[model samples]
Target: MAGNHQQLLQLTYIRFVILFCQCCAVAFALLYLRVDLNPWATGLALLLLGLLNLITYARLHSSWPVTQPEFFTQLLADAIIYGFILYQSGGGTNPFIFMLLIPLIITVMTLNNRYIWMMAITVTAIYGSLLVYYVPVVTALSEHQHSLTSLFNFHMLGMWLNFILTVIVITYFIVRINRALQRQQQSLIEEREAKVHHQQVLALGTMAAGTAHELGTPLSTMSVILHEMRTDSTLSDEHREDIDTLQQQVQTCADKLQHMARSVAEEKDSEKTSLATELLDEIIEQWNITRPDVTYSVSIQEDLPPDLRNTTALRQAILNLLNNAADACPKNIEISLRWEPTAIWLTIRDYGAGLSVEQTNTLGQPFISTKGKGLGIGLFLTSTTLAHYDGDVKLYAAQGKGTITEVRLSRRSVHG
Candidate 1:
């Protein structure tokens, strides 16, 4: 992923350099061909713009990471500089007034919804103010002032029309590209998750099978001992009763082994059970038995939508979250579930030693764990499953308190 991002950056830089050189050549040719204003000022402004572009490009290419904020700032500077040049040259009369659309187009291409709106508003304000302020000045300076009046109107009208049309085109293409990239990313993530889940299921199945095989000898020996005691005529009634109890315990263990084998075999198949409330109850019961030292309080809101109730991935994800909470709080744990119109939220809070910044940063990543025997698959699987449903997991250590893990899944009613 890092390599891909670096390659994308290099390509973007090359494109920016090419576009900058082209714009410069066009500006110089226009100055030479028709308008002979202050060449010195024009040269200076062009040189400064070129230098800014180079500096921005260098910064982007250097070791420093290019975040969304820095990208927007650079784009905003580019637009303002370009717009200033166009205003100085002729304002509404300049054919290159449409160049203002360049930054807006790039903004739509590279930014999220929030930054796109910011760029749009910025462009509208700058262009509107320039047009209101500079139209008369441009008209007065032309050689054919009377003729220039009509020509200026035509040029300004044409520029606005082109700006709107270009913006529409750019927005359409950029949205399509963003959707495509998102789909590709989601597909890759799902494929990786499937592979990991398959491996885990395989490992678990193998272990279960081995366990059952190993217990076969002990089970047979116990059965033989019980039968021999029962057949002995000299055996006391108390001894026979004891043998019967031992035999019953052995049978119970065998039954448990068989159940585990069945579970493992079922997991090997692709079938999944629905996420009924009973599943949650089962999880709680199992945890209570396994971690008797831990106290748990769970509440699932009654308002959850019917569709959400059957979401197996979500159910499993919640179970994992609960497990993590139980681990964190060997003493006290609280989990709450709430259903809103827009989302379903599950919060698991524990009063234990909270995670450090570094540990939190590595959370949900495979093979990153604080436990000695941890493979770190639980959180990774949980995160991946939640993400599939357009859900998110947030981990935070409360101030002067313990850690909290919040899992939020977009409501099917809203998202679908």
Candidate 2:
């Protein structure tokens, strides 16, 4: 955090106006009132005060923000300038002497008792010194009270009371209100970010559905072409095996798209069954076909729960994780499925050129990714998909030089 540089700048401008008024007051006493005063001494003092404020502002680099101590120092300067004005006018008898409290009021708004007490002591010392020695601005004849002097004194006292009361009221009530407002602003920012994240996830789901629809015809054509090539008479035995593998992979993709379509149509069946194989098995088979370059092993607990039945969604999310792992570590990957009493835990460990622990932990954050060309949407969507089922994904550094990702799902998701 920059130390309140914005607030400091704002206060600095307000102080300039105060300093300007003090400078003008001295000029008014000498020229208009024709009072006996040391014009050059007081005039030069006020000028130096303004110069110090300007210097302080100039010294504030964008990188080096003004701190609490620096802000306190500015307030101290204000008190000193006010003290100088009082000394030339009439010591504690100056009409505008209440301006010294301006510094104290600012300190109340921005600093704690420790600094406030320090300021109080400093101002008290200056006021005490002004009482001992000061140049009188008003003549001795003018100081002698006239009938009009009593009325003028009453007016000055009223203004002083009003200024002090206003400062106290604002410090007590407005400071607390401002703090509450800041908290509300922070909450609104967080809520806005969450809404944007949710919208991005929804848009990703829509795009996936549209892509599945568009690819259906092209996949069918590819399957037919592969089938015809397999039937050719002169094809070698090795070539025939490759064609069979390619055909099966293409058919698996088609089946996955069909399942995704069914889920989208909201088929209201409480349960679903596939020919002899479970949903989890079908997912693994499809994933294995897609990631043919990497070797992966899966382990299941003794009494595993049934699949959540929306295999395409979960399958696609896990596929994103596996694909990310493959990109990071191509040699080998290990997947472990363990069943807890209330939850199911799935872990994917990769052993290749591993990323840093900090890098892996931030895998699913929007716009942040470990991959060179990745846009970071894959892991974001994966995390969002798992969150729908009351699940979470976490990434960690492996024991050696690799990354490990663990995903946990509430048991109710599978059990339901």
Candidate 3:
């Protein structure tokens, strides 16, 4: 709809230029060139067109939108008006008769195939009629050397001018309109991709919730068996230690499932808010508890703002990226936080084997992963979740070796 309106606006602009040039050419022919032409008929047509153009410009600002058919009617009106102008100014013999082609060229470029054919037929009919019936041009020199040779020479000059003007009109208007269409096409493609990504994320969330529910009963049975085994005095000391470790692992899994359930509920209700600095600290602390073997450094600027909407999804997104970095090189990682008035930047670097060109290109896609046994959903889910928060992730090859993950959060999304 907006595109149609914009095209209408462009039409108005083209009409204004054509009208101005037509009036100027007519004035020059009458006063300077001493061409004998009927001013009353041509003057009335130009005046009406100018007044109509003003009304059209005013109508564009109203609540009503310009439909495609209405636009076609406008171009049709232009062809008819130019037809009248040509009839009074010597029709096909007039040097400016080629002005009729303006409306036709503009229509072909901006309108649909149906309108293009309509404009083509209208302009062709008008020009053909003028060839058979039109006012004969009479100049002051017509009584002198106005022989057939002189008239032919004059027509050849007019043809040259016509060619130049046609080239200018096509180059100026058609090229710009084509570029705008390409940009619009690209925007639509991006929108469709985003819609598909959201649908995929929704499906994954539903499946994860169902899987978490199914794991609960088995985890409970394992917990009960582990307790019974712990109390058995017949077990060796070394075996007891192993049982304790296995019990802790099962308990960790149970706790995570419970946390996932709570996070799901909370996300549905409303996301909780926290200070920006404190939220970053909490996410890092949580990641550290899960991946205790990885060591990381943190540096946050002191000029950071206070309140930030920290959803569970956002926390998990950061955690997923951190885990990706840790898996790359668990022994050494660098984390930093910086902020501007309208954005927050978080950078995480790891001293691991850097990504290959193919991996870098397809990193966030589903089933594409850097780790040998990675599920590949982690980065994709992280990227999809961050989009809801008005944030995005970028990865680059670090100075020597490893990948640098940069997460950018919009200040408006964080504060609100």
Candidate 4:
């Protein structure tokens, strides 16, 4: 609808230009060149065209959008007006007779195939009629005593003006149409990429759920076996310690599975909010349990917002980042938390070897990781999950010192 209105508006503006030029041409011919022509007929044609353009301009501003038929009608009116002027002047011999082609070109570009053929046939028929029915210019030229050389010169001049006008019209409108097409193509490409990304995330989620479900029975069996093994009195102290560690690892796995289930079930109702500092503290504390050996420091701003969100998805995203950082460099990691009125910001700096340009280029894509033993989907999952909250994550190299990960989340994610 908007496109139709816009095209109509463009057509109206072009008509205004054409009308102004036609009036100037008529005045120039009668006053300066003293060419004998029907003054009342030419003037009436111009006045009618001016009125049509005025109405078109007013219609463009109205609540109702311009329809294709209305646009075609306006173009047809323009052709009829131009045809009258052409018939009065010199018929097909008039240089401006080709001006009818302008409306046809506009119609072809903006309208459909049906309208295009209609306008084409209309212009063709008008040209054919003018060839046989138009008034001859010989009487007007003989009365004005124009020499043959001067007549040829005037014809050449009119043809030159027609050529310039044609170039300007075609270049301007065609370039604009080309740019609109390019923008539309770009938008479609971006939309397609987003859909593909969502499909990937969906597939990953389905696989993860299936894997967790399948592992439950084995993990339970391991837990029971380890418990019985630990009860044996003949077991050496070292062996008993190993069994205890294995049992604890199994329990952690079970806990993670349970947490995943709860997070999935409660995703829709996760409107719980917390202070920025509190959420960071909880995430860090939970992270430390899995990576007790990794050292990290935190610096949170005192003026951070209190209504920052504390969703399981957000926690998991942050945890994934921290785990990635730990895997990169186990020691001397830095975590910073801050916020503004509209957003919360978290920055994690890992004091390891900085990422290479190639590694950073593909950081957030699935199955592309900086770590040698990494599954590579952690950052991809982190990115996709944060996107749900209108959040974004960026990774930057810290001047060969380490990699810095910055996360920003909109405050609206919590307020809801």
lDDT of each: 0.67, 0.73, 0.84, 0.85
lDDT of 4: 0.85
Prediction 3 TM-score vs. true: 0.89
Clash count list over all predictions: 0, 0, 0, 0
Model 3, 167-205: lDDT tens per residue?
A: 776677777767777777788999999988888888888
TM-score computed on alpha carbons, candidate 1 = 0.43
Candidate 1: lDDT over CA atoms? 0.67
How does model 4 score by TM-score?
0.77
TM-score of each: 0.43, 0.44, 0.89, 0.77
The C-alpha RMSD of each candidate to the native structure, in angstroms, is 14.3, 15.5, 2.8, 4.4
* Model 1: per-residue Cα lDDT over 299-369, one tens digit each: 77775333353344555577677777777766668777776667777788888788899988889876678
Model 4, stretches more than 4 Å misplaced? 1-9, 27-89, 101-129, 133-154, 273-282, 296-309, 334-346, 408-416
- Taking the tens digit of each residue's C-alpha lDDT, what string does model 4 give over 14-107? 7777778788888878876777778898889888988888888888889997688888888898888999989988899888887899889888
- 274-309 per-residue lDDT for model 2 (tens digits): 321254566667777877788877777767464454
Off by over 4 Å in 2: 1-179, 234-239, 266-349, 356-362, 365-376, 389-391, 398-400, 406-416
Residue pairs in clash, model 2:
none
Which model is ahead, 2 or 4, in terms of lDDT?
Answer: 4
Q: What shift in Å separates residue 110 of candidate 4 from its native position after superposition?
A: 6.7
- Candidate achieving higher TM-score, 1 or 2: 2
